[model samples]
Target: MNDLVCLLFQSHVKMITPMLLKLFIFASVYQECHGEERVDQPDPHIAEFEGRSVTLQCKYKTTSPQPELFWYIQKENHFPKYMLKRNKYGGEDNDAQFQERFDSNVSSDSVPLTIKNLHVSDSAVYYCVLQPTVTGNTRTLH
Candidate 1:
């Protein structure tokens, strides 16, 4: 099933920029698929026109039992700004900045970040950190 998930995701990437599967991890605590292998993570870059909106997708191939995903934005020369600091369940968090402009949602293994009312200040490098709910060592695709 994990392999199938990776396959389906790979096929989906065709419509956009091609994706390469560069990481494979074996995690034991994940109940989704202990021995299953997954791949074809999300693209690392996103370009959006000013005043427009964009959905940043973070997809990872893993059966991690309770992966709590966090999205962080780091502007050049500035510290990383975090979204969804506390309330992390579903729906948009009512407290970030600028009228709750940033909204996030998660799917099986992907989290799409939607930033509204884009501005020059909103431009930055975003990162998705998925730390399993269980404690364990971590490594990412190279």
Candidate 2:
């Protein structure tokens, strides 16, 4: 009876060893690739007059499982202000201060932020940020 029980336990461990190894490999690869997102915003020095509109171009490349896009603005000495973001769930958030003057458009590989009726106080740097969208873990043990 003792030998039979020992044999069963050994078989159980052997069956699970391969699955555990595969899960570990998948987790590491997922972590490494999820951070592979890059955004490009050219025309670092853009100038415009008061009451005029300015559109900043931003393009991004995402090679992760799930990705979300966002836009932010940073003033001279202030922290980045969350202007707007489009989540994976199709929800959108537009800042109250930028309701009428600020607008954003998202395409397949591009998302540009546009400001209308520009004011002197709006002289600041804008940034395009992309992040990984998290859904519930889909991994299941067979």
Clashing pairs in 2: none
Tens digit of lDDT per residue, candidate 1, span 36-96?
Answer: 4332337655565666776767665445565566666655555445665211355444244
The 10-residue segment of model 2 with minimum total lDDT is: 1-10
RMSD in Å for candidate 2, one decimal? 21.5
lDDT for model 2 comes to: 0.64
Measured over all alpha carbons after superposition, the RMSD of each candidate to the real structure, in angstroms, is 11.6, 21.5
- Give the whole-model CA lDDT for all candidates, comma-separated: 0.51, 0.64
Model 2 per-residue lDDT tens digits across residues 29-133:
754666456667765667777777778787777764556778876665555568887644566779887788887777767777787877777766676777765
Residue runs of model 1 more than 4 Å from their true location after superposition: 1-41, 85-95, 135-142
lDDT value, residue 129 of candidate 2:
74
